[model samples]
Target: MKLLIYDHDGQLVELEDVSAKTLMLGIRDAGLNLTAQCGGCASCGTCHVYVDNAWQAKLKPPSELEDAMLDVVEERRESSRLSCQIELTKDLDGLTVTLAPGSAFE
Candidate 1:
């Protein structure tokens, strides 16, 4: 599967091996920045990302924990989501999202 991630600079970075794991795990395992300090715990907003508008509805609604966590994201948008909460499924094979401002490797 392929995941197109737009960086803070609006550059496109493609991740090709999205296995059956959370989007954060796939992206991080690919050696990308995706901070994700909370490690899929949905407690930190560090994994913030914005789902491309066209692909927003294709995802399941966020859980309560994620919803609460999102409230803390400084750059949260209408389509903002925590990558740790999204499962990579065949249905989302070509998912596209942009890493929010605070999501950095360092």
Candidate 2:
């Protein structure tokens, strides 16, 4: 699967994933600044990302828990999502997401 990530500065980086990890794990593995502190549990909201508008409708809506987590993020927007909630699959190949500011790296 191919994942395209836009960092805070808008630099685009392409990543490939053979392991079916969630988007959060893929970002962390790519050595980006995303700490993803809660792993894929969707609790800490550290994996916040903005799905590219063109790809937004392709993703499943956030779960109730994920929605709640997103609500508290200061940078939340219509495109904001918890990357941990999105498992990468063939369907998600070529997905693009931007690192949102609320992602708590520390």
Candidate 3:
């Protein structure tokens, strides 16, 4: 399984064989500076990312709680998702996401 993360500078970080980890964990492991203030508990929108439209359906639907958190993020888009809420799996191979501007590393 693999994932492509488009960072704030538009650099794409490729992750391979990253299974059983949340998207937030994958990003953190990649050395990007996304803020997961509440860890992977989805309590904060600090890990927000915009799912590439082509890969949106491949991810699990966000829960009500996640939707609420997303609402507070001014950069939220129709494709907005909390990385912490997304679990990496073989089915998510090739998943691509762009870091939402609001959640970009400072």
lDDT of candidates 1 onward, in order? 0.88, 0.86, 0.87
TM-score of each: 0.93, 0.92, 0.92
lDDT of 2 at 21: 72
Regions more than 4 Å wrong, model 2? 104-106
Backbone clashes in candidate 1 total 0
Q: Write the per-residue lDDT of candidate 2 for residues 1-106, one digit (tens) a residue.
A: 8899998778999886546578888888888889688778988888899999999888999999999999888778999999989988778889999999867475
lDDT tens digits by residue: candidate 3, 1-106: 7889899889898877776488899888777878778889988789999999898988889999999999998678999999999998777888999888878657
Tens-digit lDDT string for candidate 1 (55-105)? 999999999989999999877789999999999989998899988888886
Candidate 3 regions with alpha-carbon error over 4 angstroms: none
Q: Top TM-score: which candidate number? A: 1
Minimum summed lDDT over a 10-residue window in model 2 is located at: 16-25
- In Å, residue 16's CA in model 3 sits off its true spot by 2.1
Task: Give model 1's TM-score versus the native structure.
Answer: 0.93
Give per-residue lDDT, candidate 2, residue 74.
Answer: 72
Candidate ordering by TM-score (highest first): 1, 3, 2
After superposition of all CA atoms, the RMSD between model 1 and the true structure is: 1.2
